[model samples]
Target: MKFIYLDNASTSHPKAPGVATAIANFIEQGSYNPDRGQYSGANDTALAILDLRRRLARRFGASSPRQVIFTQNVTMSINLLLKGLFTAGDHIITTSMEHNSVMRPLNEIRAQGIRFQVVGAEKDGSILPDKIEASIDANTKAIVVTAASNVCGTVMPLREIGKIARARDLYYIIDSAQLAGVLPLKLSELEADAICFTGHKSLLGPQGTGGLILSDRLHHCRPLISGGTGSFSHSEELPGALPDRFEAGTQNLPGLIGLAAAEKWLTKQETKILKHELNLATRFISAISEIDQVRLIGRDADYCQVDNPGRIAVISLDFPDRDNADIAAALYDKYRIMTRCGLHCAPRAHKTLGTYPQGTVRFSFGWSNTVSEVEYTVSAIKDLSQR
Candidate 1:
């Protein structure tokens, strides 16, 4: 039987056309660490890294390439930014739909006298800007939120919330793990202080590659890790620079190079890919909505008809009378359809959506999925529901 992969939200499969080749070429050519050696090969590597940063800056609409700081992944980027920016007695504002990447770090910092308020999102994973605005106050230090929910792919009202943050003079940080590459992002419009993104997910790049785009307005965030940044090695203290201050130790050169190639490939085909994924999601939702046992989570099917209802190609379904995990397993075993079944690491989101203990089965479509695959999956679900 042929297999269908629909878990792009976790990590994209068959990454961009040249991603693997780029990594392979880098390895075959003898990978060199930039800023560490004085040789021409090392200098060339350094320039390549700079070029990637410049590309990312242009893509994300950052003011300068120097403001782009890379980390191992989105989780590390969020931890570094949140921990460095907050201190005792500070307050933060986030949402119930955030992934563990943001919530876990905030939970850890809470022990240090820093407190955060979660503005509850609607049952459909939609958040209101006023609710977030109401949550902010005198002690509020920053507003950190995910651009879209990983569980349901409901896009947040970032522009409105960013406006609120700017009017209040508060820092706005966004976790773009599920947003980047899936949607168009322009930093100037969002008024964000930082956007943390991972290359493995919607970016269609390999793992171990991600970074942050920082605004010039944010200056006081201290370095989370302190070590050799290939700059100011003679000094005992960390270097006081844009990227070197936050980036410590050896970098992921191979992964970064692959990500660069992936970005290049994705830039040309983003619109067509997005349209295809959305159409697949629309077909799946329409078919599954007719089944009595299937309960669609997040946005209703009507939202798909509009030009943009602020949603991605992620769909979650709950078999109220059947075991969600069992359904997922059956789909994989009997039909060769791969999916994720559980709270998806966002327990708070599950609680908000009212699927807490018995989590839903998530089918996140990707650029490569086709209408025939979606129809077959729907047919399988219908057959299983009847049985």
Candidate 2:
């Protein structure tokens, strides 16, 4: 049976053209470790890594290429920044709509006498900059928030929040796992101290590829992991450089190559792809709203605003009397329609949407999804609602 994949929020399927080919080519070329040797192959590999860094820096509007550091994934990227920057007695302000990537690390650091405050999002998953500012206190050292909600696709007011962070002299960190490729991001304009991203989601790259784009303020923060950086092998301490300071040991060369291919692909079609995905989402939401048994989460008046960024392709539906997991399973087993159900690693977000204990069924569209697929999925949901 032909499958209809709607779980792009978890990880994008059908990655950009040439992603797999790029990975295979890199591996076939004898996978040389970058910056570890002086041979031609190693030098070429190092150049490729540098090229990827520069490409990412330019694409994201960073001041310099040195600001981008590759990590295993966005999780590792966020952890590196969170653990490395904050210490005892530090305070952080974030939103309830954040994914575990932001929440879990903060919880881990709480034991070190660090504290964090969650600025609750509106019922429609929209965060107010004033709410964020109100949460700030003298001890507040940073503001960490997601660019978009993974569960509902509610895009935060990042520019306003960034301005607030700047005026308060606080670090502004953005978890852009859902927004990197689907939205236009100008880190310089956002005034973000650091933004974390993953390659497997909107970036359309292979898994195990992600990184952080940070400002010069990172020079004061410590490295999460320190070891042989290949640059300062002669020294006992970690190299006090931009990328080499955070990146330790050998890196994910093949994955980074795939990411570079994906980035190139995204740069060429960002506008068209985002419009297509958002249009599909709008159609899906309109169709699903007509079903009596379906309750759409975060689809309220605020979400319907023309300028509301919350209207990305991610949509969540709750069945008032039916189990969301059962609905998801039925969609897969009966119709070959794949989706994600439950908390989606964002229990706090579920709590904010009042879907905790029983999460909603999520359909996250991607560049490859079509209007026909959305129609089919809506038909199936409508048919199932009556049963």
Q: Top lDDT: which candidate number?
A: 1
Tens-place lDDT per residue, model 2, 11-98, is 9999999999999998997799977777988988888888889988987888889999999999999998889898899999999999
lDDT tens digits, residues 1-387, model 1?
Answer: 899998989999879999999899988997989999999889988998999999889889987899889999999999988899888999999999999999999999999999999999998999999999999888998999999989998989899999999999999999999989977777888988989899999899999999999888765688778898889988988777888888899999999999999999998998888778878878888888899989999996666643575788889999999999999999999999999999999999999999998999999998788899999999999999889
Residue 145 in model 2: lDDT: 95
Q: Give the clashing residue pairs of candidate 1, or none.
A: none
- TM-scores for candidates 1 onward, in order: 0.98, 0.97
| Candidate 2, superposed: residue stretches over 4 Å from native | 300-308
Output the TM-score of candidate 2.
0.97
- Cα lDDT, all candidates: 0.90, 0.89
